[model samples]
Target: MRRPLAEQLPSTLVAALSSAFGVCLLETTGVLAQVLAADSVTGSSATVAALLQVVASVFIVIAVYVGSIVTANTFATIIAGRTRTIALYRLIGSSASDQRRAVAREGLVVGAVGSVIGAVLGTAITIGLVSVSVATGVVPSHPYSYLGPVIALPIVAVVLTTWLASWIGSRRVLQVSPMQATGGAVEKSLDEAAGGRGRSVVAVVFFALGGALLVLGMVIGLVSPLGVLVGVVGGLLSFTGLVLGSPLVMPVALRLTGRMFGRSAPARLAAENAVRYPERSSRTTIGLVIGVTLVTMFAVCVESYQVIITNAQRAQPEVYQGVDRTLTVTVVVFSVLMGFSALIAAVGMVNNLSMSVLQRTRELGLLRALGFTARQVRTMILAESAQLTVAAVLVGLVLGTFYGWAGAQSLLGSITGSPGIVLPAIPLALLAILAVAAAVLTLVASVAPSRRATRIAPVAALAVE
Candidate 1:
């Protein structure tokens, strides 16, 4: 109960929003399908309805996947913050497994609470919208029950996934030595991170398998569009490997990006601080990476597909006349849906930044005691934020561009009358928008933390446990 609000709000918000998205998406899909099925005018309404359901399922899965990652990251940071307390517990009589299970239970409770609230909100909005649509004659009235057992699925999935994610995140508890109870908060150094060979091996295995699958997907594209499905699996597996190996990967990226700050004292300190704690910096930035990657991947996929469509239309103008409009609308709609996942990630970033600042009170105070000005301290912190954001966005753009190009080629190669390379179409406009949004997010998230860091007296902050 006494845990800081920052520690809990991110996970709760993620759970609630994720469940709400699931419920609303599923219910809305069913309603649309029902309406389409009732439209006796179109002979292919059933097929279209089926497609809608599949797309909705995919969107839901993406949401849950993003939510799970964010939840896990949030819990991992929280566990890091609780190092002192956990070490104390270990020093006395408690075992690591017991402590881990307790954290999982807390996750379960949070998931239940958030899920129920989201489910109720989603149900109400859905019911209200259906009633309005019916009354407005937009669709014919039908016997549709908003309350159904299906709603339970999102609720259950959220609860169970949260539990599982918490367990995964708390794996660090097993490594907390009772001797560390005397020490204050401590984040893993690069050397310590390098020693985790088990994770590195597993990550490499996943990467190898995913890389093989990606190649196979391209080969299969020569024959069928079904290669896109295989590509999706490959992308997921490869991305998982990247996340697992981030402890090793992110530090190098951070060091490279940190150089952009220059050779000033504050700049050097900011650069050093970011690479000083590999785990902390990686956790804080991975969410942004996920967000940017999704947005860019979708943008590249749509633009590349548009390119192919444009060529086809030029060849047969009559058949592809209105297809462009439909494509535009589809991209717009999916982008909005994907935005929710990005929003969840944004919340996680802000939450992690706040917690990082809180955990580093003593470090900041020590710097102050060493005669560092508040402005320099603030600049250092902000610089760290900017450095991480830049690194994450750069990585995301590279990954997303490749994935998007692969998806486009694998899915539409046969449509071009032969299997061939489809050059990726990068949308500069959309990329600019993403970059601007990320910059704003970093600035906004950094402000409060900087203020908090500067406000505390050196002695007072040093006294914090």
Candidate 2:
């Protein structure tokens, strides 16, 4: 009655990579700040260092937040896959709480292992980079200690967050009745999802409140840049509301996007499969939404900022030239940092897709038994991936563009005297690239699942309980 370590590897890898990325980012920022502050000629070097530290902190938060969500979803899917095993345990007199506690313990162990590995890897990377920089005279040679108590921040944070996320994800265990031991695992139907009207109502309330706050922030922007802070809070609340109501939202979005593909048998089946279980589909795509939204938000904000600066530079080239250069560097740095979150989300998407395929073995097998060819099954899965990615990308782009514009307007409206009147400056090149990336991502993500689906013998897969 033991779970193989391999079953937990995805979540563990996510935790490790997230923690390692955090540590590396922190150390790099710290070292850069130290080098700058060491320059005797730059009087404001200390202040600049403080600002860099703050930016790095924001990046770390984004990474941790994305990583936590991915870890939670991974655990949730794992629990769902183990429904029958858990039910059997329940039949043998095991309590749900005990089983959940055992899962939590497993999570703790996974977190501990990952955090340690990440911390070591991050430290080594930082040391290597610092040594190279010093040797090449890129940075002022100084005795910088990569080993510090500060490193513990990411380690502890990853460990605790992973543990907490696992606990939340395992909530499904409570719903696993011993009676399910006699039946196969199942997901909530559309009707069941719709029956949760209370949750939907709460989601609406939060969303409305957040929308109100966003409007207020825009109005306040007419007077001061501080309004952006309010806008940030509003964005968070509204997004949380969206996430809570995703079961209601993502399916409709998927349906609309699914129509973009030809209505062939495989395509139709793929579309239906995606919406058949709202919870599963919603969770699978939401991570991509978050990733796309964040990346696009930053891109739009930067573009808008550049546009405003360019106009000002035309008026006073000398004064704004340095500012323009600084802005460019800042955007590049932030974009790279934001990429970490996107990567984490990408990992979640791949993990979920893989698990969804694995869990649907019987369903896939049944299709094959019903005269569906392996090629048809593979096509159906690939189509599903394409539709999901398209839906997520579209949603993310819209939300990100709006949020990015709002952020820019809230910050720069006072200077431009336009507040919410300014149009968003979306770079066409970026949009094209995203479109290409989404396509490539879909193909890449679906390959393994499609292959696995095709290779499984119909009789063997159908025999799985």
Candidate 3:
């Protein structure tokens, strides 16, 4: 049965309300209890309120980083698939303003859906964690300040922030030219191939510069918060080189490893395709690399931080906690960092694969003309994603596992510390499986775009030239 938009809206609003209430309630429980302990209505109410607000803000920011990237990439591909629809509207006398309105309408839908779900999930997680905290006496249980400034003001602010972020990030809908709409642009020919030496050069140079600055920031302890910003940006920029630089490196790397791909026909085909448009492929690869590096770097930093705190704890108990709480915090923090990183990587995989699928639309059309079923063509595209996920994940797991182990041993094995656990096979395997599954899910997201590409008739594709 089909559901009306109005019906959906009410449920969505109900969901949103439940989400807003729970989000404020669970996260603010600890500090809210403190405020209540201080009576929550005293002159210091304002001060305690601010402290609780800060904690909520921090968690919201984490949600933003983790949630935003996946939403952006997913939305981008969906909207890109709409270029033809948008172009048609323009041709039929719709102004750019009209086109933008359509884009905005779509953006609102996506933003609302994502934010509401995120809020609900975030709230549920907060409640579970807080319940555990209270039971463990990590935080005292008391009534929370949920009625006043604590709930009303911040909920409004968070909703606005979420809607704005999604809207802004999905603004690429405005960039499609009406002339490109007729669906041809989505499946254009090799002769019309784009992205030049300039992009490659820029990516490579940025890669070098980002690396230099990142190393410099690390050396200097990033004297300012600006340093952290620079390191993150620099880390992202390095992928410009790593991805664009892939063809140059990949061919050689693959020449040594090409036979590995030959173990399977699909792998052999996927590898050839990966190298076919090395420049574009590298751009896609660059995105994944950015995600992987950010995650791996942050993962290393977090573990290192814990090791330092733990070693200090080993020497003196009173200096720290009644017991080692750092380990618990470290796991949560590292897991959060990796989840965000892996998500970006997953999105990167989706973005690159969608573009690749689009680029090969004509090929799929031709295959269809030659009697291949639409599902079969879609399978080929999925195969490409599967192959890339396998290859990228294998490399990432090997390197990340080694780096994690080495970093832990160096930081935790000294007299100042007891040797913390290294990359135990179980946890490492779990994370690896999670990363692979995430990459596959990302590939699945592009299924619609791939099917859309396959829908193009061979005649139209050939005419697309």
Candidate 4:
């Protein structure tokens, strides 16, 4: 039964699984690339090769972390909507453990299937890409030797990840009492779940700790690798603190945004809707927050490093000529990697928004029946999307830029003993552009769901579950 259901899972689940598979595939391929480089480089010392492998391994770990979080969140969203079904099983005399087992089994099945398919697809892609690169003289042709282990790693990693994600995701189903599930009260409103005052206190604690670490790191300066480590860790903690505290901040931000629209009905509706379910809205925006924050942080840090390097190059032009080239490569590589992570996160946002629209079908139908125009419905969605995007981008930019600056100060202090701050004008502009583009894209993603809502006859939509 679980196997059949797993086979018939929704497209969204399939998509999320595919993304997880892709991330694993990329990580495996990275390892392979490192191996190939190590083998082919004639003059490189063993230590250099070992360091390269370690770096690749570190990247793979990061990829796994990001991929797992996204997968878990996506799975949780899908499972949350199935409270009634789970309750039905309980009503039919299914034990809680039985239900849990069923869910775990289904997850295992999905993971096995998705991982196998992903491995095949990844192999094909890797072969094609490597073939093209070799043919174009961008890379030297080498006999691929690590193919077996390379393919095996992603398959194992992705399968385990998906299985874990699915199992943990289903735990929420267990939390819903049969009575609450049957009563259609399984899901709690954001305000209820967040417990405003308690959450605020927790948020404040996180902020204080993160801020203290960041300030301490700055004061200590980056005189050693440990200093760099402290700064990086501090920045990460601060970002986490911000995300955790977004719920406390969202209400005021939504109200301000609504006021900016000045009596527009759609804007007011959008803002109210967002505030009405703060938890849901925060979850939707959190993905964007993660993505934008990472991209901005990386960009700012790289640009700041460039500034410091440029200043140093002026004193020793010939010795630092290659430094600029290395910096350029570093920037490009990280930009692409972080950009991919951001794209995955954005997909999560789309899923969240789509689910939100779906859950509101009945409400939307009522609005339509009451003579609200389809255009107004669409406008409302766009307004909601724009508001979330604006809030996410603003928070992400501020946090990321500050972290980048802190990292730069650390690095500069380590290298030159004088920590001078330099703001990269062009990178800041680009960050703004990226933010706008993401907001526009999110608005565009809302179109399909909005159209579907408007197309359903009010009566028919109201009739739907």
Candidate 5:
């Protein structure tokens, strides 16, 4: 039977939606900037109607990407699990190359469909928002202005990038071997198999490039304020690479530290798990770490902007003289959203860990039978989870600190706007926050799986095969 296009359609539409969101962000931000630059209420109000168009475009794009990723993640995992199905097809005469083509074709369809949908929806939204704004008498419109470049280019680009992103996301699926798909061979350690030795070279190169960019950013600060944005983005990437390379050096450090823990069983086991597969564990936690770190980071960036805006208002207090309260409210709302994103990521990590533990029921049962008590096993797994979350937190703290200081200096220097001098209390507050959240998340993640481990009967566990 031929594969139906509907099975692949959702993901393609999703890719397009994600792209639309990115474009909408750019457009809405531009409109907001324009509003901020305006001197009078009437002038600023004129752009309010246009903002609806930008918002509509943004949501359309977001819907497409979210849809695509959901579809892609689902299918990718399914394909990963359905090696037997593919192998049966091969046994019945489907060639290996044909299998690859089918999977790749599905990916292409997902990307293309998502892209087209996102573009169409985004364009329609932009038009609708503008139309609605005019009808509400918020702003008088003669004809649609700024429609071509902002609306048109984004739609086309989003459609194309959707396909590209989906393809990239699914590329790893095509590399699975037939025997593994057929369950002829058990899966091996992806991290342990991938040696982390040469990461130093990559880190060193990134650090060097980042440092060079920092200097350039300082130079550009005098010419255009955007240089600060450049510096922030570059520094952020460099810091990510450095932290990633931490595991390359982790085993050496952890081995020396583990000697002290050798006297205790739980400690020893925990230490071993922490350092044993640094590459793999680190790779697993990278996405969550980035998400978590962004919490403190977004806060820091907001503080920088708050300072800049505060200073600007101070000099021309009349500009925001009446709207000071309004500005503060908006800033607080943005900060809260950033914090929520981090909490959501923490929950996701916990769910992901629980799912992994559940899937290894047979392996865990055998470990239990081989002299490991339920308590010890639970302790060991929790310890491993703790180690990863703690490392991620520490790394995030370091990155946040760098971002805060660099962003502060950049904004102040580039724009000649400083809100006030920093207090010693801020670092203490941030550090305390990092420690508490890390501990809480670790304990919470371990709780569910720990309970499940104790619930299994040894005979039933052993009989899983």
Candidate 6:
């Protein structure tokens, strides 16, 4: 029955996507807020209202992009874990196309249901929040008449996103052969599956292009005034390059971290386990990379902007005070909006780690039989989580700092007449706090799976094949 398939599917992914969709739906109220405020302002021009509408639309697009990527990554992890199941179906004479269709159909069903629930929940929450704001006199009373269209947009967007993610996630399922399935080799080494030389070439090219673009953007800022926007674009390209090149980089990083803190048996084993399946580790960390990258990038850029404004305030204090306050508010709001993406990333990491642990039951059981304590097993899981968090945070910080420095030069150069790049003082303590939080969250998520893993007898686990 379909119930079995449903059970195998990741319910957490469904919930995360639903939450993301609900948040996106709630954002539509920004447009409504703008329209209402414009109507109430005695001297507000139609042009100003139209501009606010455009800004709201831009935010919506950004929300959709973040939501789609998170959904796709989560779904892909779930699909990848089922590689053996898909292959078994193929071995029993089920066509690859049929299996793919089944997966896609399941996605559609989940998407539809999740979208409806998200829409309803989002609407109710938004209404409640707005009512409180109105009562507190923080916002004037406004009619809730625009809720209908606002509710529809996220439902449509999420449904389409889920469908696309489902289709894309199934591509790997189709590539898995019956032989690989039977051999339990569905999760092959990245070098073997990706072709070592080809991957290297691609990585090198992307890294070079990204670096070149970043430098070029900085240079352009020295002469032309449009460097700020160019730098931002280049920063994005650079981060994308880093992500694409992670398969090559992850092993080196893992080895270094392992050697540094892997003196203990549990730490050593955890490090080895992570690098042994480099592709899986990379995939598991991609969501975290996306989330952390955005956070660091925004943080650095805002600090740079603050520096520029601080210098300007010395000359015309009153004239720039309003601009400074507006920028501050903008950064805070933007941070809150982007925090949702980070939340999704955390959820994905937890799900991926849990699935990975579950898949290694046989290995864990053998270690146990060989006298590995339950405490050791738990420590190993925590060690792996720590290593992943370190990698993600380090990458984010380095790239974000560079981008922020370039952006500052670009933005300030136009006004100051060829200013040098000034690196913003990043809050290392805050970043450390974030890294620790991520590690703790991942470790907590591992508890249940670790417990399940330890409960299986060695003989039973070894007999899983």
Candidate 3 wrong stretches, greater than 4 Å: 1-68, 136-183, 187-202, 222-260, 263-269, 272-299, 314-323, 336-365, 371-379, 391-427, 434-465
Q: How many clashing residue pairs appear in each of the predictions shown? A: 0, 0, 0, 0, 14, 0
Task: Report the lDDT tens digits of candidate 6 across residue range 139-183.
Answer: 446565435454455566667777777788888778878767666
- Among residues 3 or more apart in sequence or in different chains, the pairs in candidate 4 whose N, CA or C atoms overlap within 3 Å are none
Residue runs of model 1 more than 4 Å from their true location after superposition: 1-6, 21-57, 89-98, 118-155, 316-325, 416-420
Q: Could you tell me how far off, in angstroms, the CA of residue 84 lies in candidate 3 after the best superposition?
A: 2.4
In model 1, how large is the Cα lDDT of residue 154?
A: 74
TM-score of 6: 0.79
lDDT of 2 by residue, 127-185 (tens): 87678766765565788877666667778777887788667766765677888787765
Instruction: Give the clashing residue pairs of candidate 2, or none.
Output: none
User: lDDT of each structure?
Assistant: 0.74, 0.74, 0.49, 0.62, 0.52, 0.64
Taking the tens digit of each residue's C-alpha lDDT, what string does model 5 give over 1-465? 245564343334335544444344344344333333442542354333443343344333433332333333334433433345566676677776776666666655655565556556545654555466557643244354333355554445544444444354334444555454445323323364346447667877777777677656655654444556666656755764555465564455445545543446766777776676564354434534554555666567566556666776677665445545335433543354355435434644554455445444555677787888888778776766666666666566666555554544454443333343332113356567767776787677676866685568766775542
The per-residue C-alpha lDDT of model 2 at residue 317 equals: 69
TM-score ranking from best candidate downward? 2, 1, 6, 4, 5, 3
How well does model 1 score by local distance difference test?
0.74
What candidate 2 gets wrong by more than 4 Å, as runs, is 21-61, 119-155, 315-321, 412-422
Model 3: which residue pairs collide? Answer: none
Ordered from best to worst lDDT, the candidate numbers read: 2, 1, 6, 4, 5, 3
Ten-residue stretch with the least lDDT total in model 1: 41-50
The ten-residue window of minimal lDDT in model 5 covers 416-425
Cα misplacement distance, residue 394 of candidate 4 (Å):
1.6
lDDT, candidate 1, 338-399, per-residue tens: 56546655776677777777778888999999999889888888889989889998988998
